[model samples]
Target chain A: MNDSAIDQKPQTNSIISGAQLLIHLLEEQGVTHVAGIPGGANLPMYDALTSSSIKHVLARHEQGAGFIAQGMARVSGEAHVCFASSGPGATNLVTAVADAKMDSIPLIAITGQVSQTMIGTDAFQEIDTFGLMLPITKHNWLVRSAEELLEVIPHAFEVALSGRPGPVSIDIPKDVQNELINFRPKSIDSTDVKAPCSALDENDIREMLAIIKNAHKPILMIGGGIIYSDACDDLKVFAETLDIPAVQTFMGLGVLSNEHPLSLGMLGMHGAPFTNLVLEECDLVVGLGVRFDDRATGKVSDFCPRAKFVHVDIDRSEIDKVISSMYSIHADVGDVLRAANNSLQHVTRPLWRQRIEKLKESHPLRLDGDDDLFRPYGAIKTIASMVDDSANITTDVGQHQMWVAQAYPFTRPRQWISSGGLGTMGFGLPTAIGMALAQPDITTLCFSGDGSFMMNIQELATLAEENLNVKVIILNNNHLGLVRQQQTLFYKKNLSAVKFQQGVDFAMAAKSMGVNGMNLGQVDNPHKQLTKALREPGPWVIDIPISETEMVFPMVAPGGSNRDMIHGEEQ
Target chain B: MSNENQSLLKLIVNNHPGVLSHICGLFARRSYNLEGVMIRPIAGSSSHKSCVWLLVNEVEKLPQLIRQTEKLIDVITVEQHDMKESIFEKTEQFFI
Candidate 1:
């Protein structure tokens, strides 16, 4: 272990309760904020919080707390913390924890369990939190005793933030939290917690370079790993030097600015028609820090059919798990790119670039009614235009999320934060609240649809309490638009239980929650109203009513090849 | 007891309450076919480690399975062995 420790010296040979010790250790780990709710089991930890410097944001629900912490972690690129009580609190946190696991965000979820004696005895609020969290988290622990907290807490941080960062849970029984221990203050060093990546084999790097050099048409497929590894600059340089057109996975968006000449934007599923077309004809696919997710690679057998894949990721399991690669390097992508840059020569592929330009001209992403703010694409574009590159964008999963992904001009890494792998609805408001909390200076835009906004609508109360600058723009369509779209396309228009029977007055709902609310439909000058709403500070819900019939076009039907795209009627 | 279709995997893991669950959960969730499992604390070892042997019939996915298993934090090492050298072969009489 590196001798460096958290920047605090502990008091020697002091007596402290397990709860107090946990709080102190968290302080040492530099956790400034924790999002959670107090319940019967975790009251001791909550009591300990009163005497600590850390600020607690009491969320309306445990799921909100979990995503709130995720928002902070995703923005800061650090292991952040959340807390919940046993049973329902832990269960409620399941989706957010699983979301972190899928997205590889560094988060530490600490749940309070029932007393040690009551474990497995059918005690009230007693469920097997460790077992519940085991499969979803990277690692989980059930603290056996008060003394074990010292080891478990720091180790949880290490496991969560180290190689291939992910969420981890530590379940502390109420009795253990109340147990008194003779604490010997040992310096817990988490500064060097990140595991040193294994040394890259020179032969593998040489082989990857050779494949890229020899291929007639090479494309760079980047993903979330690039952002996690902080390799955006290195990736940009590598792609530019090789003159390779880069296509981002949903998680990989913002690694290259949408305006970059070589940028092909997002690929697969709801990707642009031309972007997916480019992938079909490419001879070499050099995937850096990507898993070739099913959404990004529609039909795995047909994706990049003409390309020889070269996958470089930190995790060995991701290799050959989805798509087999001709050259696979199980090392950090940033390190690999840095090494490749040393020997890389500036090369140009005029013929391949010309071919890509031709495809782009013929089959581009259709943004119908983008000039009208009432349309989905138009709403997203207008939001993007209002904020500078410093603004952070988040979304709840649905038609609105896809619209933002398709239309938003994401220019920097960590700028676009959404639920990618899990595709969880109701992810926007709380996560954007987190973004606002982490970076209070910049505006955080959450583009949510009516169906997704209602899932975590209760979190508006939490947002009201924080009073942060998070503007939630609900593209009100009164239905699960994506589900309805699929029903129309693939299910023979057999719409089942997708449309909402009752209409919700979202503006009134926000106002009832003690936050600012606005309805574009009621305003005569929507442009003026929107500009004023976005420019002002504090939380606001801007409800823009859009037609329910609109669909996200250039979509590849589920299980279909990316090449066989289903385009909507021309604008 | 040994067969051409069976493969033996030896895992050295931290001996703890939920470590076994973590290992077993991975197998179940990934849909990997696990034929049998045996686990015991490493005798006379001070480090509190255990030895686990998994008998599986997934020859094609063994490499990927091993890679996934190695990713678990509690697992110390994974070694592949042939069914001919399996501990299940030696302990067959107990089950019979």
Candidate 2:
């Protein structure tokens, strides 16, 4: 990509319609496929796609199309594209677009709008596309003319995939798509469309290094931003070199390998009792790319109460948002980690490692040693052993998501995809399909809950027909497990609308839709059964029954301190 | 204003088509409510650039919100002012 925005227009403009120009720009961006649909306003663009090499995968719903784009972005770490028509089509794509926004997925969402003349006339298939999309996109445009497309199209991709990437929308009017104009393939002013984080002040790094040298008991907190900035390698070298105990936030799971001596798994409300206890005792915390979110820090004031912080984040806003810090570095995690490592010397902390080992042994994450008929925890552990560490694991929201995070062993970044920020249910199947489609060399496993699966279960058709090598594991608990646990814990165990009294035969449903399905119930050999099903060709849905009474433990009560957690012993 | 009234955020952004929506979307995702908005092209400019003033209800996260606004790619400068000082009061007289 050029350094700045493409500013110079073509020396000589060639006549072309906006629809044709849009196609040419897509070709320029090296787009292989798009999740989209055709409608009245967007038909011209759809027609253009027919002749173009960019394959369009027709989605059953606009939301599904949006999610497909999200899934692709998550796997490829590149800007993906999705399209929908005006009015209801654009409305349908809203959830997916919003999801992309919260998770920082890079996507270009194009919607067809009514012709410019009919924009405000209350004509058929007309709505305020630009206004509706304003609050849901990273940036959006109402393309008034074909001439504007020359600048807007390239700029849209640059904005979507640049620093702190997110979804951008372009609401193209039908008239703009249909209008013919002299297409200028000239250099447009390409300004840097990203505000890069300021570099860490050298003095700040030295001071942080001093803090590291001084503290006897310190921990490294890994967050999702590290993964986004590709600082995993740098973080590993730094943490391992200094022998610091490292704990990952939900999004930071693979910054350090699960088996590493420094790795302390995930920390937060649903964190291990031992991990939380370690946080309570630490003297200093070096948080890299993590926001110290409420879920991660139970009560804001009580998190690492005595610990001084050396916070590093690309976004300056996240630096002091939750916990006040002794020092804050408003720079990209990679740059800061690289610079900090140079200033520090290798020093081992045997005493700190001993303390962590004791903590880990005292409050182990799982009690079960093997997979059984009912424990999702054991099942995850078994799956961890069966699949390679590099396999892509995508999860839906709820108990299963936590189970995978806690039980499975992740060794690298970009292998774990979940709706962390928005916690959107029904993200599993379609996301898995999209991710697997993007990278066919590896198998993708979608861990889903019954409640979450039903939210967008129609995507099962997409999974079945596409023949993507995805393994769908349904931890069927017959209830909204996490929500039920929350109500039980806080609201006097009143089981409200959380139960699914009449559960559908998920295996049968999946089988009918052209994929292999197996319902392993009350099985004595669950590991063997699961492994056999996963080995089958194409996509397969494996439904494993779980107990409704089972609840994830070590949960810190809302607004309560990290130490104020409710463990299994308390229950 | 007791830190609860609508505050005007003036942003000087590169005249990119996507700048305005990006600012709005960031606030929306955070569930931050906006009161009003106005966008105008800067005069005497060959560069395609514009100024946007958004009136959003002040909350506890005002500082964080302003910092995020500054991070948007096209946004060059961000200024915050009391709603009482907003030109909306002056402009409303002409329209209403």
Indicate which candidate wins on TM-score: 1
What TM-scores do the predictions have? 0.97, 0.90
Tell me the tens digit of each residue's lDDT in model 1 across A1-571: 2212223334667667788889988988899999999998898888788878899999999999999999999999989999999999999999999999999999899999999899989999999898889999999999988888887888888888878999999999999988878878666666424343578888878889998889999999999999999999999999999999999999999999999999999999999999999998999999999999889999999999899999999999999999889989999999999989888999999999999999999999889999889998888888788878899999999998999999999999999999999999989999998899999999999999999999899999999999999999999999999999999999999999998999999999999999999899999899999999999889999999999899998889899999999988966
Q: How far does residue A404 in candidate 2 sit from its true spot (Å)?
A: 0.9
**Residue A559: error of model 2 in Å?**
2.5
Instruction: Show model 2 residue runs off by greater than 4 Å.
Output: A1-14, A368-370, A522-529, A569-571, B1-10, B14-43, B48-62, B79-96
- Candidate 1 vs. true structure, TM-score: 0.97
Model 1's DockQ score: 0.71
Candidate 2 CAPRI grade: acceptable
Restricting to chain A, the TM-score for each candidate equals 0.97, 0.94
Best by DockQ: 1
Each model's Cα RMSD: 3.5, 4.9
TM-score of chain B of each: 0.94, 0.83
